[model samples]
Target: MRKFIVAFFMLAVLVSLVSCEQKESQVVDRKAEMKTSIDSLESVLKAAEGDLDEDLGLQMIDAYVGYAKEFEADTASVIYWYKAGEIAQNIPGKELYAVTYFANIFEDHPNHALAPQSVFLSGVAFDKMGDKERAAVSFEHFLEAYPSHDWAPDAQAMLQMSTDTTDLDTQVKAWLENANKTQE
Candidate 1:
């Protein structure tokens, strides 16, 4: 009985140690992946800024978008998108362009690796553009739609803190009335 108890305890400790090691390995792998993504994103962003040809610009954007999709959940996603957005701002006639691009990642790829965070950054771009109302709406939508997401708390805080000067009451009332009628 004593030997059996010792064996069981050893097994349990081994399992616990393995679990912790696996978690640490996962964190290290994620960090390495994020570093690679950042390096790739920085090059593309730099090229996009220096090259004026439409095709080159589009290609750079596409490359950045692809990497952004892959590393969207990685710690490097925010920084990558911010740099991409900065480059995009130089493109003329591209009003709220970054918001639209990032929003599409959330809209079209809701189950994607970076969807929740893409939505959060989408709200951020809107807010940066001085469209606080839409930013709040986007953040609220992120919270309601992705309540279980890793970024939900951040979305909720953003919504609670957002101050919209626009008369959102009218739109909210209209939406509620339509929703109620649909239920009936």
Candidate 2:
């Protein structure tokens, strides 16, 4: 009876050790995959810095979109979604997808540091896509959710500006340009 009990104890210990090792391995693998995705994205962004061809830009945007979906639970998803939104802005008539990407960051990771910016950008994306109603809604949601955020004032302004009938795109573009400059 004693030998049998000892054998069972040893098997349980072995199983526990194996389980721990497997979990550790999974974490390492996930980290490695995230690093690879980030590196690839950096490469694509660098290639896009000078003389970016439309075809290549589209391909890169597609990749970033895929990364955003695949890494949704990962914090790096915020970066992937943000990059996807920025890249999608260059593509004609694809502004809605950028809005979706920005919305994903805010919806899935509301506590993330980038969530407030994502909310504001989603409003801009909707405005650029010519959906004033949705843009207003997004801006309102941003204000409600992040009233103390630095972008709250801008969000309020955007909500009001989205009501205008003339040159909305120009206004939004100017606001985004100014925001970018301020960030720099």
Candidate 3:
């Protein structure tokens, strides 16, 4: 009876170990699946490089943003989020998504080379969306963070324009022209 009881306990222990291993395997499978999805999305983005149809680009951006949100700590997440923000800013009715994605980049990877650009673009996205208050805030944040960046003058102009009450399109055009001049 003692030997039988010991055998039963040993079997239970083995089963528990097997179950734990299976759970670990399941986690690994999930991570692999996520990586595959991210890679596939990146490939799609790459394939669309020259064509860049707005609808398809928006779809890709949405997919990338979804994956970025799911894998926030991954390097791919930062790249995907930045790409999504760039695409979002150009698409009509998607400026807020651009703002969100750019803000995410700035918040998650503040030391990255793209962080200042993200902040500036977030302001542009807000301005494009007609949210002057938020646009001003984002522009101010960018200037405070990168006072001497090449984009600083543009950010300052945007901050001033945000409170100008002028036609947004006209202001944006003037700012772009001024920015181009500065770059020249």
Q: Choose the strongest candidate by lDDT.
A: 3
Tens digits of per-residue lDDT, candidate 1, 1-184, equal: 9999999999999999999999989877866766675566557647677555555555555555666666567545544554455445445544377776666566656776767776777777676666778889889888887889888888887776576344669768877999999999
What lDDT does model 3 reach?
0.85
lDDT of each: 0.68, 0.80, 0.85
The candidate 1 region of ten consecutive residues with least summed lDDT is: 86-95
Clashing pairs in 3: none
For model 3, residues 49-157, the per-residue Cα lDDT tens digits are 7566786777778678777776677677888888889888888898998888888889878988889999999989998988999999999999999999999999999
Give lDDT: candidate 3, residue 110.
92
Ranking by TM-score: 3, 2, 1
Evaluated at residue 87, the lDDT of candidate 1 is 48
- Which 10-residue window of candidate 3 scores lowest in summed lDDT? 36-45
Per-residue alpha-carbon lDDT of model 2 for 1-184, expressed as tens digits?
9999999999999999999999989877876776676577567768767555667667767767766676566666688788778767667787888888887788888998888888888788888887899999989999999999988889998999887776858878988999999999
For each candidate, what TM-score against the reference? 0.44, 0.67, 0.69
Looking at model 1, residue 143 earns an lDDT score of: 86
